[model samples]
Target: MTEAHAGFAPTGACWICGGERLRPVTRAIFEFSAYAQQDPELARYTGATVEIVRCRGCGFAQPAALPSLPDYFERMYDQRWSDEWMEAEFRDGTKDLIFREVVARLSDRVPARRRTLLDLGAHVGRLIQLAAEAGWRAEGVELNPRTSAYAARATGLPVHRADLRDLEAQGRRYAAVTLIDVLEHIPRPVEALLGVKRVLEPGGWIAVKVPHGPHQLMKERIRGRVVPGYRPTVADNLVHVSHFTAGSLRMALERAGYVDVSITTAAPVLPPPGQGAARAGRVAVRRGMTAAARVLPFGVRTPLAMNLQAYARAFV
Candidate 1:
């Protein structure tokens, strides 16, 4: 069962571990009025809210409240890519490479002939497709009606076009599950994982991936001196709601009844690592840096944490 609280707060104790050593790391203020004045849904927001709590014991940075469910997903959930870009970035080859590793590792965690794998918040079923090829019964969930239909049609797999909140009522369970870059968007990750746990067989694994803050770089156009500790003055649809250090992530999984957890730093192909990092006047230099990232050994590549890929098995 999930407990209702006034949102994770300063001096409010850690939500994952119940430790009280909380700290205020940074403050974020949102002003939706300019955008809200034009949009109907945006008007519901309380406007600007200050985020001021961090847990020193577990390194979990919890905001008071997150963007409402619809506002977070409906309007901001556009995964559009241009044609040429899609050709280069959306290759099944890239996806297969990533999923193959997970499937192989997960297979060792459990043994069965026809294993079932459910992908929460699956987009286009790319991962499911790869898992299917690796000899598992793969399926996915999508909120977008059109994309879910397309995924079902393309891959010949069942894709539930619904949210995780409603999944239990549908009578679902799986041998393995995945949530790639999906945890940050939800208003409540704990409840979300509880739902995930409900659907997985005991001893099965849930593999998770999310963007590590250290690796994302955005150029700031400014008029003065550049220094350390510079974050974007504002955040938008792409804003990260929950931020987790390795410790916070481990605690989250531990609380969810997952044992023998491990987090690995995996390199996610940056679609066009070259194009995004390229500068107007310094193409050659930037390309070199991008290539370096490709071969760079996985370690604390600072300013960007290696994209957080966590693997945990359900407790036996």
Candidate 2:
């Protein structure tokens, strides 16, 4: 529901790969969403006029006019202590659902008694709260002061308002670092990953989930707005700069020094192609999808997949 503005003309090289051949893919908008923090006013944003661009080389997707730092944080931040947004968690709680399952899956590596975990993008601290229920002493770093304060008050846990990279410099460290759906937001994911490594113990584990590159691009490729009889392509809200596939994710993580990295794909609860949404409920949507994928052959899986990736790169 964003304002209608014309997309920018493409004349420059791609942002990441620097390929001279970059192209405009879509003219769309993403509204202020409370998936991260709790802010009713954020809904006021309605949406932003965005010119979506694609890199022919790496297939990275980003808005041509991404909000400046001030606009991205200060303006759109949800600082109103809005309970409406917090209670609306069940509506779009993909971030929490993925984090919980990831932790349970890696429970073998992380002891039940482990009580120290850090979330880099802990807006409103929902992931940290969930981790605490499982005995993890969770802390987080969120840039939005409003959400950070609310998170601290609500969860009684520390949600520092600072850049993730600065945590290590401030004499803070952690055992495990969870970056759920964060890599996609950062302008420089590699740098953020490096910073995450600095605060992690030697041989610590990092669990990351990124949108499957090909899967997301496939939605972009669909090339139609009003299909006679089909659900809209899950609203391509590609605010992310880097869309990481299994291969690209592995490469970037390896360069960031994560050693034992493995990638597994999760079919979204709403199975691709209007298969009537995987299982209909919040919990079942994703968990059920993963369970179904485990039993079925690869031939009958959703092309749009979520990556439940866990890797232990070098601790140095």
Candidate 3:
């Protein structure tokens, strides 16, 4: 299939595998933000077309092209985004559970006597805080100055306002690296992993959490056809450039030279903004999901959940 184009530029090749063999997945021309639908001034972006494509070579999915994102992101975290998201995440102990899972996975595979963790895209520094509490020396790399500053002030953890690429210049190595919900937002995920490889100690581990592909959006895709509220668009998630299935995520990790790579699925956590009656219903659903997640085997959840956690170790 011909590569899809967005506005003026061509998407070139798959960001994960550098393949030109692409398959068209879906197309939409809708506003990314729910609020944009109500405001005429902001609604101009509703007309912009976006095409989601899957790479036949690597099974990776991404948009046809990524537009200039810095401006959008700067405004997003500063204005629309909040540290409350992480606070809420911890309220139910999900983030803490994830931290323990990552630590245990690395402890089993990496024979390092001491563990030092670097959380890439560590917005608000909750992971670092959790790691430090668990006896791991932790620091963070964040791109947003505001969030980085907040993370340092709130958690007293050292969070550098820079990208993972900047760590190569510091010459510091870590025993573990984390990318929670971070990989998909990056335009060059493979290149970022290469940088991660450079900054890790031998036998060090990396843990990543990302949304499960195609399936997470299946309902939205079906709904957009019949309901205006569910129209598929990239506006709200303008920062996310890629989507990963279990196969694609594992492939990316192996391609970057990781060993003993393990991927597992977790219970689906519904996004926020629940109404009065619906909010109560969502809470009940979440409670049930939390219970099921505790007992469900990894084999059963891997194909059914909406999120996946991956752990990989670097080798000599």
Local distance difference test, each candidate:
0.62, 0.62, 0.70
TM-score of 1: 0.71
Candidates' TM-scores?
0.71, 0.70, 0.77
**Candidate 1 lDDT over residue span 1-316, tens digit each:** 3222222233355666677776655556554455444544543443445563566776565564555435445654544434444344335344454567777777777676748999887666777888888788999998766567666866799899876556656777788899877786654466667778877877878988765532432232131127566544322332555556666777788888889888765434333334444533354543345345445664424333445668888888
- How would you encode candidate 2's per-residue C-alpha lDDT over 1-316 as one tens digit per residue? 4433333343255444456655676555556565325544444444555566666776655556544333444554335656667545423454555667766755657666654788887777777888888878889887767667767877898888877557778877776888877787665566677778777877777888777655665654563444555433422343565666565576667767678887666434332232344435544656665666556565122553555354554455
Q: Where is model 3 more than 4 Å wrong at Cα?
A: 1-7, 28-46, 68-94, 110-112, 222-228, 233-237, 267-303
* Number of the top TM-score candidate: 3
- Comparing candidate 2 with candidate 3, which one achieves the higher TM-score? 3
Question: Model 3: per-residue lDDT, tens digit, 193-305?
Answer: 77798779888889988877675676466678999676665324455667787778888888888888887774444435436778669767754654565467754244345
- Judge candidate 3 at residue 82 and give its lDDT: 64
Off by over 4 Å in 1: 1-13, 29-38, 43-49, 67-97, 163-170, 213-238, 273-304
Model 1 pairs whose backbones collide: 23-54, 214-303, 214-304, 214-305, 215-304
Q: What lDDT score goes with residue 1 in model 3?
A: 31
